[model samples]
Every structure is written in C-alpha cells, then in structure tokens.
Target: MAPKVLIVLSSHDHFPANGKPTGWYLPEFAHPYHVLKDKAELVIASPKGGEAPLDPNSVEMFKNDPVSADFLQNSQELWKNTVKLADVLPKVNEFDAVFYVGGHGPMYDLHYDPTSLALIQSFSEAKKPVSAVCHGPTVFLRATSASGQPLLTNASAVTGFSNVEEDQAGLTSLMPYMLEDELVRVTGGQYVKADQPWGEKVVVSKTSNGAVLITGQNPASATGVGQEILKALGVN
Candidate 1:
C-alpha cells in the first residue's frame, strides 16, 4: 500500500473583521490533491470536521481547471466528511506525512489551535514530511520540537504570503497581523519570496537541525509543493 497523507484544512469559515466567508483555498487543495492522490493514500481532516468551508474567491479561481473540476465533481464526500484534527493527532504515526492547506481562515483558527500544534510536532518528531502553503504556514506559529525549541528555528528557507502581497490585497488592516512579518519577525524563520506577486515559488529544504519541510509562496505554488512532498516521501 502507498503511504498515507493527512490533509488538514482550516474550518473557520468567517472572516471575523468584515464577516466575509473564508475557508481553504480550492486550488491549494485541488492542485496538491491531483499530485498526491495517485501517489499516496490521502485523508482529509479539519479543525471542526464536516463540510469544511471553501473560500468563495477560490471557487472562481478554479472554475476552469481540471483538478478543480475533479474536486467539484467528487461525490465521495471526502472533503465533506473531514475528521476532526483533535482525533487525528493521536494516530499521527499512521500517516507518512501531513499537509496543511491554506486560506485566510487559518489565521483565525489553525494558528492557535492546540491540536494543530500537536499534529505538526508529532510529524516533525517522527521525522516525517510536514508541508504547508500560503497562510497554512500560520500553524508553525505554535509548532515546537521535542526539545521544546522552535521547530523552524533552523529552517534554511521558508515562503508564504508575503507582506507586499497582503498589502497589495488591501487586507493588511483586516488581518490580525501580517502573515509574512509574523513568520519573519515573530517566528524567527528565514522567510523569503518571489519577486512578482502570485508568482510560483516553492522552497524545499532540510532544517539545519534536520527536518524535511516543503513550503509554497501562494496558490500558484501548490502543485510544486505537492511535487516536493512526493520527493520527501521518496516517490518518483
């Protein structure tokens, strides 16, 4: 049997400040799903479980994409039946890797969810691959190593939504804190980015202290992040 990957998505669907609906970005999940579905067994889970919200904007972004079509056409209820994150943490050893999909929703929940912190820490301590993209990196804010040191303290390079992009999106004031600056200034990780907005930039590196991590800058980098995960899993 192929290795199993657990996909953890944020269930917080409301944008607190403006009360706008927000959830996982479709492309981030679809693109990676297409890449890993054939190579590994995937289990979808969420903080709250059951019908995790899909960001309204991502619906239009993926309207014409085949992977998106597969997602929309999926009648399996895989996404609809997402298990709770709290339940999965204890069985972390059953999964070969764990992937956190992104959306602004994570800023509201996963960033501070205790179960999320445990899941990430569980994967890291097992020396298994832990991947995230865009706002998904927010989970790292609470991830720590077995020794209780910052898990990303030795990461060579990590990328996520940059401050410039957030500023360009005109959501700076709306967000609790800028994801980019929080990762760089607060988390103390070496955050970097692509030159152009929405450009595809995937960074795969082993932390100086030895941990396999793969991160993507934005939605466009989703597939590449999956490819990196395959590599980390020793899949061709």
Candidate 2:
C-alpha cells in the first residue's frame, strides 16, 4: 500500500495585523503536492474544514510556474473541500506522515490552534515524520513533544521562513512574530537558513523524542521538503 500523507493547510484567510487577505501560499502547497501526488496517497485538511483560501498574491506571482498553475487550475477542489482536521485527528495513525503548507495565515492560526497542536502531537507520538515549508513551520512554534518540550527541541537542525526573507518581503511587521527568532527562542534548536534570501533550503531533523521534523525555508524549497518527506517515509 502507498504511504498515506495528510497535508494540513491553514484555514485562516486573512492577516490579523492588517486585516489583509492571506491564505496558504499557492507554490508552497502546489510544489509539494506535485512532488508527492503519485508517490503517496495524499489528503487535504484544515482546521475549519472547507475552502482553505490561497494567498491571492502568491497565485499571481507564481502563475508562470507550470506546477503551480496546473494545481491552481486542476486541484482547486482538493483545497476547496478540505476535511476537518479535528475530525481526522482520531484516525491520525492511519497516515504515515503529516505536512503543513504555509502562508501568512498559518502564523496566526496553526500556532495556537488546539486541534492543530494535538494533530501534530499525534503524528510525533506515532513516530511519524512531520514536515512543513515556509511559514508552515510556524505551527511548530507551539507544538510540543510527549515530554512537553518544544517539538523542535534538539532537532538536528531546523529551517523556516527566515527573518531576512520576512524583512525582504516587507511583511516583518505584518507577521505575528518573527518566525526565525521565535523558532530559536522557544526550541533552542539550530535554526539555519539559506545563504541568500528566497533560496531553496530544506532541513530534516530527528528530534530528541525520535520524531522526524522536516522543514523548508521558502517556497523555493517546498518541493525538496516533499521529496525529503517521501524519503523519510520510505516511500518511492
């Protein structure tokens, strides 16, 4: 049987800082989706269970990318009809891994969402890989291990939407908090980033508790993150 992977998306569609519209980044989700589509059985899900919005600007910016454009056109229904994450929590063991796809939206919701925290915890407890790209790693800011340490604690290495990248985007103030900073402050794990902003960077770490934590630094790294997840799951 193919490994089952649950892809979690943020249901929050607007930024709290400016009330500006934001959702999952198109490329962040699309790139990974394409990478794993055939290699694994994928499931789309969100906290609110329906119509997980796409960051409009990301849609516009990545419109030229063939994979992003293709997913935007053909896979709308997957995101439009996400399963309720809470509902899926009970059956978490049925999957081999969980992936979080990011945009500005997740910084506000998934970080503190009880359902999301519990779901991530479930995956870790099951000794499954938990992966995310870009702002998706923000979800780990609050997710804890069986021993109640930050999930990233003692992770071999970690990466996320970096402080430099956030500043370059001019969204540093719009974010709830600097992801790279908080990731380090809370976990004490090595938070590394690409040598250049917006460059591809993926880090796959085995946490002290034995859960695999995979993270990518930006949209450019999303596909690599997916590939790493497949490798970790022992999927072809």
RMSD of each: 1.5, 0.9
The 10 consecutive residues of candidate 2 with the worst lDDT sum are: 182-191
- lDDT of candidate 1 over 1-236, digit per residue (tens): 79899999899998889998888888899899989989999999999988888888888867898888778788338778999998898899999998999989899999999889888888888889889999998888668887888877888788899888888877788899888887786446688899899999999865433669888999899999999999999898
Please name the candidate that would achieve the greatest lDDT relative to the true structure: 2
Assess candidate 2 and give its lDDT. Answer: 0.90
Pairs of colliding residues, candidate 2: none
Per-residue error (Å), model 1, residue 14 = 0.8
lDDT of 1: 0.86
Total clashes in model 1, counting residue pairs 3 or more apart in sequence or in different chains: 0
lDDT of 2 by residue, 1-236 (tens): 89999999999988877888999999999989998999999999999998998899999999899999999999899999999998999999899999999898898888889999999888998899999999999998888887898787778788999888889898888876899998888667488999999999999887657888999999999999999999998877
